[model samples]
Target chain A: MTKQRAGLYTALTLLAVLFLIPMIWGVSSAFKARSDIFEYPPRLFPAEPTLENFRAILDGQPFWSWLLVSTLVALVSTAVAVFLCCLAGFGFAKYQFRFKNALFDVLISSLAVPFAVIIVPLFILLAVTGTLNVWFALIVPWVAPAFGIFMMRQYVEQSVPDELLHAARIDGAGEFRIFLSVVLPLLRPAVGALAVWNFLNSYNSFLWPLIVVSDPDQYTLPLGLQALFGAEGRQYDLVLAGSVLAAIPSLIVFFVLRKQLLDGLTAGAVK
Target chain B: MSTVSAQPSWWRRNEVRLAPYLFIGPFYVLYALFMIIPIGAGVYLSFTDWAGLGAPQWIGLENYRYLLQDNSFWTSLGNTVFYMSFTMLVVLPASLLLASALNARGLKLRDTFRIIFFVPVVISPIVVALVFGLIFDGQFGLMNALLQAVFGFGGIEWTTDPLWARVVVVVLVLWRWTGYLTIFFLAGLQNVPRELYEAAALDGAGAVRSFLSVTLPALRPVTAFIGVTVLVSTAQIFEEPFLLTQGGPGESTLSIAMFIYRAAFQRQELGYAAAAGVLMFAAVFTIGRIALRLFQVGRNA
Candidate 1:
């Protein structure tokens, strides 16, 4: 039994090390001066450890602007999605209106539709509406996440009792008032989970934003990073630095909301 | 009962009851406009020869017929399938193995490991591709540089060489996805009843034997979900290959999604591209159904 326990510990440690490789590489590579990045045997530590890559990415590119775009879009979209999905999730979970099951089925099945398949039509829609250059194009499509609604529905159904809702209603609470005061408070944990999911999904969004926004100033961090891939001139260190920049927000969110995030992901599988 | 008046009529009496729909109305309307209408449009556009701006010329069944002979489309389809299969073969086992290890008792800094593993999934694809592109760079890449130093061998041309390019793509997919799948499997592992393991051990089942007989079988549903999702998502792989290889090294790494995008946007053949997408979607759906059924049967057996 002691031997078995030792074996498991050894295995887990090795797995953990393997997982840390890329991230370690990302940060270490960022500190390497441009010239040292492609050095033979790839020294794990840079001798000079210059922040040239970071400096170049920051000063040369509109890195701050792009980061701002990403933050605004991720935050605003997450907020909108959480608000809308909570109401929808609560309605589906608590109330039995006409065609409730059918509507939800449609919503869930819509999950299979990949964004790549819809990019062109969305582009066309935005183009016709003359909202092409506007930030609305970047924000709107992500604001109504079906998965968020689905997860929120599941969480609310299992956790929030209908008796509580009825009591609140019996006390002459308006429907919206009941939702805001009663339902939203109980949904805090699920809301935290959904917030992280929506933020990451919105922040990491690629295809739609790639096609919709043509202007550099309008570019999100992901799109801006893709723009760096242009030209034959390869500044690998700078690219890695930029990638590290792109990854930090989502990584931070995952850490801070780790429990909720795990629950959100596992919710589907465990169900 | 005395206080209860006539039940509120569906429309007038319960107009306030419609608040949920009112809250949720925006999403459905947007989905209908951006998602539903486009899908319908995509299906229609597939039959017609629509370029981006100009009026679409009706070419019923012709685009599909052309796709039947389009060698590049077939090649792209084949490549995507190959990539997906390779990812499943390599990454699936790795994920399960890692999850098992992580589930082991008294692991140090396990949460830290989970976060690190999940970093790839959270990072933008463009960043992943960019870093990978540097690593796979033919001459200046760290991969080749290391190969030269350690093994006294010349670096393989990763992006420019056809076979190597495909290998790099598979490797990228593995790197990006392995952690995501591991987390799912870990979750699945957590829900597994601990008593089953104790019972298996008491029956004199070795670790390997017990895992094979018990844990693997128990994880069948999550396995099925992961398998179908991974395959479908792999089939639609775009940004990684788009950024890394740009479907180059002689079109060896061109995914069906990339093919569709190229045909539609780059070549301005929206009709043909839509047809290709529809075909790809059908292929994915059919495979997903088969995989799901097989998983169910395997579980039952």
Candidate 2:
């Protein structure tokens, strides 16, 4: 490589390190006790690294309960979203139907509308129906993600052949059976991708849960973490611990399913 | 084949095509309940006098009229614009440059670097705000410590001072979003044809020239998508400002969404809040379309 090329590479290396600093900070901060956090010279390596924050967070709040609630909600919601998206995607991809394009357009356009725009009426509707505290409040809103359907449709169109569906039907398989037996089994990759995306979104969600679920007992992880910052008092150690705890599930899921996560994001963007 | 079955007319076929509708049934029903009806309700309520738990009075265009004269509403709008521009002008380019550099073939440990850069994108924004809040702490912060180490000057009150608080919020938005944008640009860059780069080189185009002529044009769609999404999302900036400054040290970082949330949830002025939301929705959609169009024109040129 030329001198300039080498120099450019070195510069890029520095940039990457700069990008890595926050994650380093988060992990390092999580390890430090209260005194070590605000040290004057700022300790890159905490002199007395501790897991007190983790312990406190687990003990102080109903951290375990909140974690369980968030996990269940994210998993259940993603499963529903993936299943519904598969059925819809296969139908859209395979069959020619009346008003298909019109219905699809409505769903596509709905993707661009911000969640904030719908919060008001949805909140009112939830309140009126008295479903505010139930798991359904979070699950129902996510069941029919427009982007998920769009993604699955794109995947199915590209991957699932029409002949397969025809052959299955020729064997006397019903439409529902064809979907369950033929289309869905082939859609596992898209399902996996959409599932991770949905889980991350549902888990990281803040605004909707904040508005809809008033009771602390019904709080998702993000909402529960937010409460730690509220009037009861700001315990920095406890908050950091809670934030770390809240982030772990998504991190594990992200790492395990990195490729699908990328696929889901870009495909979701393009479609 | 002995016989061929005839295809039925479209609607006749579709009547049994309850299959497609059935497939898509959940989304349609949920969209109506969760999205469409709510949007219509929000629009109708914007012209009324409704609090959280009461009948909405049909109070003409008073809410809109009030919004016109409200100084805080205007201030929040200005802040939104400021934050949007700050992120676009500074963060977008920085991330793009960083992405391009990382995508360079000469770069070693590429995947590790990408993962590091993408960490913030996955982490909770609320947690990011908390970390930033600590970093920008007035009395005892890492930022102040660094400042004292180098310049020996007093630390600026990051979250307390109006101007500084806005700056901090902008920084928080940038930090949270730049990594996310980098991943998008990286994805876009991976698809750019390498032959164009080789052609540019053979034509004696310098690295900069190749980047300008060959690389940038290929990134146009990705840029357009990210630019519009960032603009729209920034216009609704909430979590960072909400956690960092609590929309303070006097509404410096208060965004339109934050304003709407406060009005509806805290003040219980649901109708006026809906007006604020509708206005926000309009502004974001308008700005996004305009940006995408401008980017397309520039790309064509």
Candidate 3:
């Protein structure tokens, strides 16, 4: 048993290191001078590390603007998405109504619809309507994701009790009032999970943003980095530095809410 | 009796019944407008030729007929299927193994391991792709340098070679997704009653025996959920191939989504792209529905 356990630990530790190598390498290379980035022997840490890449990208590119756009979009989307998902989740969890199952099937089945199917027509639709603004295109359409509602429903079903709703109702609490005052507080952990999920998704979203946002000034972090990567002859220095800076917020968010996010994400799948 | 005699207002009477719809109304509205309507438009647009011009010309079945003869479309579809199969076959089992190890009794720093594994996924895919692109570049890449240092041979072309390009894409997919999938499996493993394992052990069953008998069956729902999720997502894969290889060395790694993007955006073949999109949607939706039914997902709900 001791030998087997040791083997497991050894394997897991090796795998953990393997998982972290790319990010670690990216961060290390971000600090390297352009000439030393592809140096023979490829040292894990740069010998003459400098902040030149960071300064260059920050000075030349609209780095801060991209950060601002990504942050605002992610935050707004997360907030609205969390609220809508929670409300819908609470409704599905608590109430039984006509066509309930059918409605849920419709929502759930939509998950299978690939984004590629809509990319062409949706772009045309937005373009024709002249409502292809960054904020509207990025956030409004995606705020009510079916996956979030499903996750929230699973969580609400598992965590929230029926008696609480009955008790709240008996106190003359309105449906929305009960959801706001009672249910929302209990849904904090799940909300954290969904918020982190939504934030990461919106902030990191590349393809849709690439398709929709044509203006350079309206670029998100991913698009900005991609353009810089391409424009600079596939150079890694500036883009690496940009990516490292871009990753900080997402890493911080994940680290802080690791427990809730991990547990809440699996809550739906496991059960 | 006196309380019953006092008539309740219509608002009071119908509030409970109506509140649920009102709560869920916004989601359905957005779903209809964004998803249902766009899909409807896509279906309509697939039957006509358009170039973002004045009007779409009616050209029934021409786009579909062209799609039937499009080699790139066929190649992209094949590559997508290959990726989907790789995830189901390679990534799924590997994650299950990782989850089993993580679920080991009294494991040390399990949460630390879990968090570290999951960090890759939290970061943007562009960053992931960029980092990977540098590491796997055919020349001056860290991977080649390390190979030459350790193994004494490092001449393999990673991006330029068609086969190696596809391999790199799958490797990227594996690295990015395995940890994310492990969390689900770990959660499922945790929920499997410990008593079952104990009982199997008491019955003289070995570790492998108990795992096959107890663990596998218990993990079915999670496996199904992960399977369907991976299937749908991988079918629409774009970024890895798009960023890493640009679907190149001759479209060896182009995915359906990338194919659609290339056709519509780059080539301005909106009608043809819409046709391809419709076919992909039909294939994915049908398979997804079939998988859902096979697994009996949401049957209880």
Model 1 alpha-carbon drift over 4 Å, by segment: B1-26, B148-154, B202-209, B286-301
The digit string of per-residue lDDT tens for model 2 on A105-171 reads: 6765564476666677678777878877658888887787876787788788878888998798777
The DockQ leader among the candidates is 3
TM-score of 2: 0.90
Q: State the displacement of the C-alpha of residue B176, model 1, in Å, after optimal TM-score superposition.
A: 1.3
Off by over 4 Å in 3: B1-7
DockQ of predictions, in order shown: 0.47, 0.46, 0.87
Q: How do the residues B8-125 of candidate 1 rate in per-residue lDDT, one tens digit apiece?
A: 5576457456866776677689789778887777788888987777688998999999999988988888988888878789899999988888887666777777777777788788
Across residues B131-229, which tens digit of lDDT does each residue of candidate 2 receive? 887777888787887788889985789999999999888877777778778877887887788898999999999989999998888887778767776
* lDDT measured at residue A5 in model 1 versus the true structure, 0 to 100: 78
Q: Candidate 1, clashing residue pairs? A: none
lDDT of 1 by residue, A46-165 (tens): 889887788889999899998999999899988999998998888777776777666775675565565566666556656767878647888876688876777777778778888987
- Tens digit per residue, CA lDDT, model 3, B119-227: 8899999999999988987888899998999999896799999999999999999999999999999999999999999999999999999999999999988898898
Q: After superposition, how far is residue B269 of candidate 3 from its true place, in Å?
A: 0.8
Can you tell me the CAPRI class of model 3?
high
Clashes of 1: 0
Give one digit per residue, the lDDT tens place, for model 3 in A115-172: 9899999999998899998899999999999889989998999888889999999998
